[model samples]
Target chain A: MDVETLVLVHQLYGAQSHYIDEGRATEWAHTFTPDGEFHSPSYPAPVVGTAALAKFAEDFAAQPGVTRHVLTNLHVTPADDGLTARAYLQIVRTLPDSPPELLRLTTITDHLVRHAGTWRIRRRTVRRDDTKENR
Target chain B: MDVETLVLVHQLYGAQSHYIDEGRATEWAHTFTPDGEFHSPSYPAPVVGTAALAKFAEDFAAQPGVTRHVLTNLHVTPADDGLTARAYLQIVRTLPDSPPELLRLTTITDHLVRHAGTWRIRRRTVRRDDTKENR
Candidate 1:
């Protein structure tokens, strides 16, 4: 990856975390493509398209307490003749309280494509580290 | 990074995980440089040098139950004039037995250097997702 690509991917990763943590559901949904899909272990099926994706984000943000999503260990690689890229990311959720407990650890595999000169997630699958059902 | 470099880093990452998961302590330690250091939130200080690194690997292998360190979401960037690279990796530990439970989730930041034609980790610091002290 070139320095520019690396920086762009980093920025995208950071933006996703920031939007989600701040409960900006619309902004978070905008990070994905129009027909993007998000699959999590917590959900039986994936949330697809902008409308469903926005709804999912809104529901998550409505939960009790504040969450700080800490993302790290991002690996980005090109795929399918450079039109798309695959990235692996780690997410650590922190609950703000008296002690600030760590709530969850999840790994995300993102399939991103360049849409309108910017990279947007086409598909994102999340696997919880504490679960055995999803690898 | 070039395609060759990206592939090389991925191979190195895979090798380290495979060796450690299979209890190949010597091989796992060999993935590091002679003066490499491994630091984790679980330890008070960093484990330095090849001998110490080997010891630490052996100790981890002797733990109860089997552990599969699933590594993903790796982002590698050039550092120190391209002679070294900084990579971020996520590790999920899965235990074997009835139900096969998920053990832990940790993130690793590795500093790798090209030594004698191969990439080796010079320093690796681990941060647990469930921790508050080590940010």
Candidate 2:
């Protein structure tokens, strides 16, 4: 990818993490395409569509205690004949209360597309590092 | 930040992981510059020079049981006035014995430079996900 494209993707990744960490659920949902999909080991089925995505983010934000998602090691590659890109990232969640705790370590695979001149996630799959299936 | 540079960096990352996983310690050491430096939370001080680097790789390989390093989410950017690049990546170790187990989750920050038309790591620092200091 060109420098501009790489920077834009990085920005998208950062914004997605920030919105969720800050409890901006609606904005977090906006990081996805209108018909985006999200799947996690914690969820039995994938969440699809903007409304469902919003609800998912909102529920996560409403949970007790504060959470910060630390994202790193992002690998981006072209996919779907160049129409979309695939990104693999690692996420670490920290909870600070009483004693600060490391909550989870997960890998996220994202399928992104340039929609209306902006990069948006079309699909995201979360794999927990502690899970047997993930290994 | 051009496509060529990005692709080369990606290749270097893949080769490094493959060399270690496949027990090619010397080759793994060669992925670094002659005077490369490596630091990790497990080490009290950084390991420098090709000979020391090879020893480190050999020691890691001598550990009991088979280990595979799963690297993902690589973010690369220019550094040192374009003479070097900085890459951040996440690593997960998987061991397959009685059953598959996820052993560790860590983030690696690498400084790379081009030498004789090949990209080599100048420095690498590892941070563990579960550490309080890392968060």
Candidate 3:
């Protein structure tokens, strides 16, 4: 992929993490397309569309401790449809007066498209590293 | 700065981690300039020059257990002389029959220059997150 697209993808991931961490559900959901879809091992069914995506972010942000989605090792490539991005996600959590914990490690695969001159995720799939399928 | 330079810097970090993880000391050291320097709070003094850099990598690899350098949140900017890149580093270690542990978290700052058509680190400074300065 061209350097510009790659940087944009990285920035998009950063924005996603920041929005969700700050409990900005609408903002976080908007990082995806209007009809964006999210599939994850943690969810029984894929979350589809803007409203559902927003609700998903809301539920996640409602959890007890502060969380950070640390993204790393991003690999980006141009695809026939749009752009394909794969990254490692480390979810760290911490509570008041306690050391931060490495909550989970997972891989994120994203299909992104440029809509109205801004890159947005069309689909995202997450696989947890500790899961049986991964092992 | 420009996207192409940004991509090269990210790739350099990936190569650095891979070479050190596989115990390719010379290769890892070569990722830096001939007179590259590394300063870390864990060490009493800075490691300088290609020879010392190689020795540093060798010493790190000699330690027991498998280690992976997880790099994240890279921020790159153009400096007067070269590119300045900052990234979060998570040193994860795993031993036989044991789950991986996040051994340390640190911040890495690198001053990089283009030499012989390749990006090379001129200097790298590492500060541990658990250290007094960070906390």
Candidate 4:
């Protein structure tokens, strides 16, 4: 991918993280396509479609404590359909009167597409690095 | 900053992190200019020049545990001379039979200059988030 594409994708990651963490459910969902799909062991089942995605993020926002997604080591590649990318994600949570906690460590794979001149996630699959299968 | 410059600066962060974590001290030092300087509250004094930079990283390389620099929330702006950037950094360490630990949390500010068509750090200042002054 060209530098412009890489920077755009990186900004997408930043936007998604902030939207979700700050309880902007609709904005977070919009980071994805209308038919975007999120598959992860953290969730009981895949979240498909914009409505479902928004609801999923809303539910998390309703929970206690603040959650911050710390993502690192992003690698992006050009794909026939769009762009494929991988990144290491660390979910950190800080509660009142408690130290920030490391909630989960996982790897996220994203299938991104350009929608209306901006990058959006078409599909995202997350795998827990702490799991036996990953090891 | 333009997307291209943003991408180059981001890649510079990636390169420096890998080189230092992998104990390539000289290579890590080369990520900066020959007269580069690093100032951090973690260090007793500022490390200046190529030789001092290499030696600083070399000493860290001799440490026992594996350290990974997790950087996030990068913001870059064009400067008169080059580019100025800031990022949140979390240093994580893992030892034999132990869970990965959050070593430190800090904010890094960099004055980056283009050297030979690639971005290199001219100066870097780091402030610990845990410090009272920062809080």
Q: Over the true interface residues, superposed, what is the Cα RMSD of model 3?
A: 4.6
User: Chain A TM-score of each model, in the order shown?
Assistant: 0.85, 0.87, 0.94, 0.96
Candidate maximizing TM-score: 3
Give model 4's DockQ, 2 decimals.
Answer: 0.16
Fnat per model, in the order shown: 0.02, 0.04, 0.23, 0.17
Sorting all predicted structures by DockQ, with the top scorer first, yields: 3, 2, 4, 1
Please report, as a residue range, the 10-residue window in candidate 4 chain B with the lowest summed lDDT: B92-101
Global lDDT of each model? 0.70, 0.70, 0.83, 0.82
In model 1, the clashing pairs are A74-B74, A74-B75, A75-B74, A75-B75, A88-B73
The candidate scoring highest on lDDT is 3
In model 4, the clashing pairs are none
Better of 1 and 4 by TM-score: 4
User: lDDT: which is higher, 2 or 3?
Assistant: 3
Q: Give the per-residue lDDT digits (tens) of candidate 3, residues B1-135.
A: 766787878867755775776688999999999999999998999999999999999999887766668887788988889989999888886564445688899999999998889989999999999988973
2 or 3, greater by TM-score: 3
Give candidate 1 misplaced runs (Cα > 4 Å). Answer: A81-97, A133-135, B1-112, B115-119, B122-135
lDDT of 2 by residue, A1-135 (tens): 576676677678778878887888888998888999999987888999889988988888887677677665455667873324333333434455464444555557788887777888888888664555542
Pairs with steric clashes in candidate 3: none
Q: Which ten residues in a row have the lowest lDDT in candidate 3 chain A?
A: A126-135
Q: What's the DockQ for every one of the candidates? A: 0.14, 0.16, 0.19, 0.16
